[model samples]
Target: MTTETTPKPQHPPLEPATEGQVLSGAEILVQSLMRAGVDVAFGYPGGAIMDTFHFLNRSPIEFILSRHEQGATHMADGYARVTGKAGVVIVTSGPGATNTITGIATANMDSVPLVVITGQVPTTMVGNDAFQEADVVGITRPISKHNYLINDVRDVARVVREAFHIATTGRPGPVVIDFPKDVQQAQTAFHWPESVDIRGYRPDRLEKKISPSHPMVQKAAKAIMRAKRPVLYVGGGAVIAGASEEVTALARRCQIPVTTTLTGLGAFPEDDPLSLQMLGMHGTEYANYAVDQCDTIIAVGARFDDRVTGKIAEFMPQCECVIHIDIDPSSISKNIQVDIPITGDAKACLAALLELVEPTERSEWAEQVLAWKKHHPLREEFGDDEIHPQRVISAIDEIAGPDKITVTDVGQHQMWACHFITHLRPRSWLSSGGLGTMGYGLPAAIGAKVAAPDRAVWCISGDGGIQMNMQEMTTAALNEIAVKVAVLNNQYLGMVRQWQQLFYGRNYSYTCLRRRSICEKVCRDPGSGKCQAYLPNIVAMAEACGWQAQRVERRAGIRDAIQWAEETPGPVLLEFSVHREDNVWPMIPAGQGVKKMMRGMELI
Candidate 1:
């Protein structure tokens, strides 16, 4: 059955307002958000932004008061990733605006659309370095797709509208509009422009559909038809362009196997036979081997980042041709050079290629990939005593199925979740890909659940990473958001420990979460008699935060814990005490080629 892709909802052209209808800048800002189809915003209130909050409280739009500015920004990012709408954020200047920098960088790196409105000090205090003032525009210019400082009250509506347009168009990313305190109080004639006409900014023109007769599309199609061992390498851009169906259709039509990056997890259903799960570091061994052996790589909407292309010169050494399709022209040939580059919307370019490409078979190559899958499958053999992290991820997939959204923090747990969880639909998997932000899981899950109330949202985080933004538990509790959080409590910074053990001769260093300043400098591994007691009980902390919490120490209780959390009405936290030394496998160590993957005890 073919699933029809829903086109992104466009804000209707603003209706002309009668001449000389005056409104405060804050009121105009609120009106502009409503016109942009934004029904909700995530932010924290502060003195500088109080004027906007006062009007927001009276408006129909819901304002979620996150526990921190960073959390608010992440929430907005999660909402945007799932809904294909520009997520909105409002925060005060100085620290409040600075606090959002990490989240802004995260969104910009992942190409998530967000419109952040920051409240600056009064225009009169611009150069005086006034209290609670910040140079937000200057600080965020490098990180954001675009940014503006509103000097005049009349520019509020126009700036707000253009912010959304820029955020959601082209290579989508964060946009900031710093509004001064005096401007928020100033009166402005609310003249909503019928259309935005930003000079030299024409993403709409670039998004035009390419016909199958286009020379580039024909070239890509011809290349694919001629290849014996072709691999379809996809990325987050495919998900953003809503080209999953096209990707799958092309893969099936050409008998090309599909391998995705970490950010491309849900772009193609992992359960499909031709799907190679994920490729790169921590990717399936078979997928990496397939890419290593493939003759041609049809890369769609994917930039070959370092994590994906470890030791770039040696990556895909056997590949003879590369056909890259992307909407952003700059991303093409930015990393690995391509033989055929088709620049346009991923969906459009893919559709055009599908029309021109002919169906074929590569039974020998498919068999080779399958043989590798059978030889080095993704599986962990844990003794009957311990709870493996992979089991927790698999159980969640089994209980929640593929329809629910899974958000993850960066670490071993993130890789485990990515490797084991079954993602059947686009937007079902959300993670901090490029920035690899540690504390992104819980807040992002909160935003995902808020944007999609009916869909179940699960947060998979590690013991080390979860604490980074665990304060958001209060936001979830206060808002009564039923986001299920599973903390893979390994009592160590598992990923770093893995690297330390393998490369640094087990000098664990600062990777142990239970280490204390007073403890002996040379601490042994857990159960080595020198280890101290686990610090700061996670379950107790969750209970203190007003969450329905539990601790699962054994493998047998994994399913029950997940079911209990799922059945709980409000926010729930499950601290699974997993084996401390377990490492994510099928990993190509940093700076190594994909062909040199180590799995299971091979690393040891």
Candidate 2:
């Protein structure tokens, strides 16, 4: 019956009103954000939210105007993923609020903290279907960690404080604050609370109670000691909790071979000897094998996702003990049952476990993982005549180095980037892991660039995904935020086409991007020479948006193109014509186990 939330921010809340000072709700909201330490926000303006936007003009908080409402939310998501503080977004009601659904869902799924301020119709027009009014609270309730509707302008300061607190704490996710147009215009005696007090929620108890001597920590430590082959499965929670140091300490203390989920990439450095890299579907062969053969699994801040776990019955067939430590109490055993379930903040729990456990060696386990890694190394064994997708990604990874930020869209390219790129720090690798949204890369990259302008930011997206937020290039260009984008153009929707080719006997239906009405009826073959025409030139699109653009088709052009983009300033795009049918290797088919992993075309 216990529930725990994310750790509250260390930043102290603003002092309560020394004396009553009247202010509009719009100004109150902006002041609340400034006190919450929000330096930047992203949004598009509209009628319902225009008053707040006007107040924002005078506030010190930096705002980036996005082309689309959806893109604005996604940009906030991207900004939140990398930064310590919750990202802020402001948009008008109805379609503006609804447009943010996908991005909200994306943040919800991944546990990214974001405060989205949505405008609503006049209070008197509630349920009357006034212009640009929609039930935002009702629509977003399911996706957001929490949501609120300001009934009175007097509650603006309190609601904004609560929204940021709830969004950043206890399984961090987006929070929607629906402010009516009337409320924005109304006057209030602005007063910020000294502290947030939610009656039913008490994560402080969990934080204060969990120590090295806690029963669950002791139990997990015992479990770790007994197992001859232990594996540390790290995930995004570690990143959110800033527990990478703790995670690394525990892994090295036990010398347990570490494997990360896609979102868990940077928790343990891939270059480390104990690291098995990413596991599950589209994971490294060694990491999956390590999970399958290990006797113990100590999952840290990671849920047993279907993407990571495959078939529930068949996953971890040899594992004898399961130790799960997460900040969210509900997530502990939701997917897979665990013997030792420690629920608290990841940094706290991992630190406690680190103190309880002693150093140990598992040479046999290490050798087994090494053998698996060498047997099927992460690479592309394809002909050099064509520009393979892996080549473009790997070239970029090498050029970008280990410290730069790398964001990816979903599909084969996402999996390829996961396999090829090396992320040495938490929050360095960003992707829509849970939602698998296609258009996430570009806007998210802009957000990251805004958060960390000094660092190099790269968006490795598919041709299809880039187009979804391609218009954001104008936002990046006008702002002069330099974000390098590489489009892996495989002609067809690579992942879907790979599936159709694999399970459906090559009956490629509607996956092709270049399929014209004339080619749709007769063209069934993948990589058909007859269909030479490609639409919506990616380079031209980038150029039109005031970005430095290039097109690379040959193998040699991969490095040069990526290098050029890196060297160039402002926003840049590199479109690579990759092999159309090259599928991501080491893929675990849906509803299957690691035994059924497809490296080339067949299950291993």
Candidate 3:
């Protein structure tokens, strides 16, 4: 018997394609961004972008209000680094956009992908020096990977979409999109396109991007196989390329030891048995010794920066072959003569090398390296002084453990922090390596904490450097970010002072900055008992910023105070009053070779 036919329950098609309602130009821009998957933005609101900000709030997008425009940009940078996405930063015209230039330049140098939007003055006000007007597009042209000034409201949607694409593609640098205030307010039909078309922005079609299948990979693999004592030198690019695990595996497979640049700390866990820590200027004795003794040096994703190679001619003299792999072709053979140059993503290239190289035990070479390590262990000479920077750094490392992240400003204390702290994870230690910016520690720590709230973040700064960005403590307090700051109060720009003592016959020009009293006021000439450059009491400053504060006058109190601050669930500051005359040595003076290092203390 045939079953009775049942009526099917049918639903209407979701809907056939139809023309959507026309929207304001601002609405189109917002819709375009939503299509590009921008979930969050960081910026300071101002009048020029008022219209855009108003519409932006109506969308699902979230905005993190930053204390300053510069801080907003850096926060975006930190977010980008952590998420592997193009960070979005928006600001208003004139001073607002200009304040972000430093951060833009920094991202460019580091090859971070960022989408920076600035609000332009009304189209009619262009070139008329209108109120709050500045040529942001013209100013940022040299630094950004690409930029566009959108005068017409109709082009806002297209320009923003293309900006995101350009920023994230190719070498991955920052891109700027300037939207006129009038454009943000203007209404037009909103149609979010499924794809973007940009002539100069195709990254995948490029022929120069190195892949594992390149012909040079075989030559590089051959060198590694033939060499007896190979050392793996890595840098920040390795961290950015996510090649740490592969690098460690390659080192183990080839029985090679590893050392890293300052920015490369954590790329290879410093605590790893095969890791030699860092090399060059402030590098460990074992690390430097390994470089001095290795026969084959394989540099992966690291620029042979002068700071690492120290007078390139005499650097790694025993190394006969140097195999270099970098994403940027310009970095290859720029400093040291490279025997085999394989330009590519570090992770991909390293994986290919592992496939090509046959695992072999280099017993004799390992023995020799272990012998050198044993002979040249890192020394900590914490003499019977009132305060020792080394002891403080070591205590911090012990208290915070390997899971914590440390950010430092440039100075003698920076060198000490590098020498003492042991990094156990990739990108765990962030500092201004290339720029060597003095006030980086506090702001950078704030940025890192904002990016990774769960990780313990600490700012290692000199008294001089900390003071430079003391204003950032307010930023931390405002955000309720519990970043701890350890100030090495040496009462001088200690690095410059050390240089003068070693190279300039201790002329001691402007380096001597003396405190007036326990109040921490700067004294122009304490020799005469009169004070001029009074310093703000950092502990009190922290307290004013609604943070826990402590001043450790004695050396013994430093470690405990640091431990307390790290354990405290809020922003804390520990100021250790160290000797003003202490120096960071093993210094390679201007144009000096590794052999020409100035030791911390004169040999008997």
Per-candidate count of clashing residue pairs (backbone under 3 Å): 0, 3, 12
Which sequence of candidate numbers ranks them by lDDT, best first?
1, 2, 3
For residue 230, what is the lDDT in candidate 1?
93
Candidate scoring better on lDDT of 1 and 3: 1
Give lDDT for model 2.
0.88
Score residue 399 of candidate 2 by CA lDDT: 89
Off by over 4 Å in 2: 1-19, 602-604
102-168 per-residue lDDT for model 1 (tens digits): 9999999999999999999999998799998889999999999999999999899889989998999
Question: Please, what is the whole-model Cα lDDT of each candidate in the order they appear?
Answer: 0.89, 0.88, 0.79
The worst-scoring run of ten residues by lDDT in candidate 1 lies at 10-19
Query: Per-prediction TM-score, please?
Result: 0.96, 0.96, 0.88
Cα lDDT tens digits for candidate 3, 331-428: 88898889888767778888887878888799987887788678766677655858778788898999888788888888888888888898878767
